[model samples]
Target: MGLTHEFFLLRSESDDEPVEQVVLSDNLVLYIWDSFRWIPAFNPSTKENHVGLNYHGITLIRHEGANLLKDICLSWSSLFSLAPSTLQLTGDFVMDENGNGRYEKLNFTRDDLTKPLTTLAAIADRAFLENYIIVHHGI
Candidate 1:
């Protein structure tokens, strides 16, 4: 099976509240491999970097509506170091009865001139996560 990433939105700091979850693209594995370098290898046999252990945190807005999802996308784009002008967000989403949300499709585009390969790759990672959560979680 391919590597898969999961994203979750916690309703509160306490674990009692339900959580929102989604499955992200496996392409994130490749992006992480290309973007970061591992270090201090004792031997070639055991030198592979583990992509599954990597994690990144992004803050979400506290608003109670679709704007929360938009804020998440914007925040994720910023985390990837994407310039505002280069990042474009377009999509539709819906929230379920249980307060879970998913995107019908969240599309993001960036101007090549304004982004480097690493940034572009990271953007893909962020976009995939954002889209996956929006589609599966109902946001």
Candidate 2:
């Protein structure tokens, strides 16, 4: 059986709105999981949002195994130039009863999630939405 887990969504302050469109609020979400890969609950929170110059965000999947990831999926605009003007990530690591290393919870921080894909608009020419989707990279 899989282990229990949780998820969180963190909003950052470095958004990509024009100087005239900047908003100063941050938001985040956390999703809890059960042994069968089902989300039992979720939590959301808010903060100041802006903490750096280059925007950052991350995704964490707590699976029953041992592994680490270096990359994740983002909207083409997020990779390019869009509403996501900032990014940051903070997560935790632990071992489950099965002796597998996993993340109990994940934290993601972005300026915005619904930004348009202006930079990688060209990418759409080669792939569909399924091509860029982010799935759990279990270990």
Candidate 3:
């Protein structure tokens, strides 16, 4: 009924196609939107512009981006005292400076952000440790 993100984890290190998929909550998608570059999940439908599908798509996160995200998440972990319980999720996903964010209130924790963050990190770590091609999917 609403837009959400899907994180596809590659089942094999040698495989580019993902066998498992995760649909992230819409609110978490918005809260963590700023952490990602958006290009990770490349969808042709939104070549010019789109939100749901884009946020709803699973993009790739290169090592650099993943590293940055890891660092950011670390900072967030340090910054927030409640671990994840205090991580307020405001569903204003359509990030517009002019105040166009919809579904703007929820006490949801970082469960949404945590999953992607871990997934992205795993992708990066595995690529590095296993010595494989790490082309990111568009997140």
Candidate of highest lDDT: 3
- Taking the tens digit of each residue's C-alpha lDDT, what string does model 1 give over 1-139? 3444444444432333334444443443333333322211111133442322233422222222223333433444456554454443333467889999876442334432223333333433443454321111111
- Residue 75 in candidate 3, Cα distance off native in Å: 3.7
Candidate 3, superposed: residue stretches over 4 Å from native? 11-23, 38-58, 77-87, 93-103, 110-116, 131-139
- What candidate 1 gets wrong by more than 4 Å, as runs, is 29-139
The lDDT ranking, best first, is: 3, 1, 2
Candidate 3's TM-score reads: 0.50
lDDT: the better of candidates 1 and 2 = 1
Alpha-carbon error at 59 in model 3, in Å?
2.9
Backbone clash count, each prediction separately: 9, 14, 15
User: What are the Cα lDDT values of the candidates?
Assistant: 0.35, 0.24, 0.47
- Report the error of model 3 at residue 136, Å: 7.5
Candidate 3, 13-98: lDDT as tens digits:
35767644445555555565566543233334444322122443334443334345446544543444356564554555455688
Best by TM-score: 3
Model 2 agreement with the true structure over 6-25: per-residue lDDT tens digits: 21211222322211111211
Off by over 4 Å in 2: 1-103, 112-122, 126-139
lDDT comparing candidate 1 with the true structure: 0.35
Looking at model 2, residue 72 earns an lDDT score of 17
Report the Cα lDDT for residue 66, model 3: 39
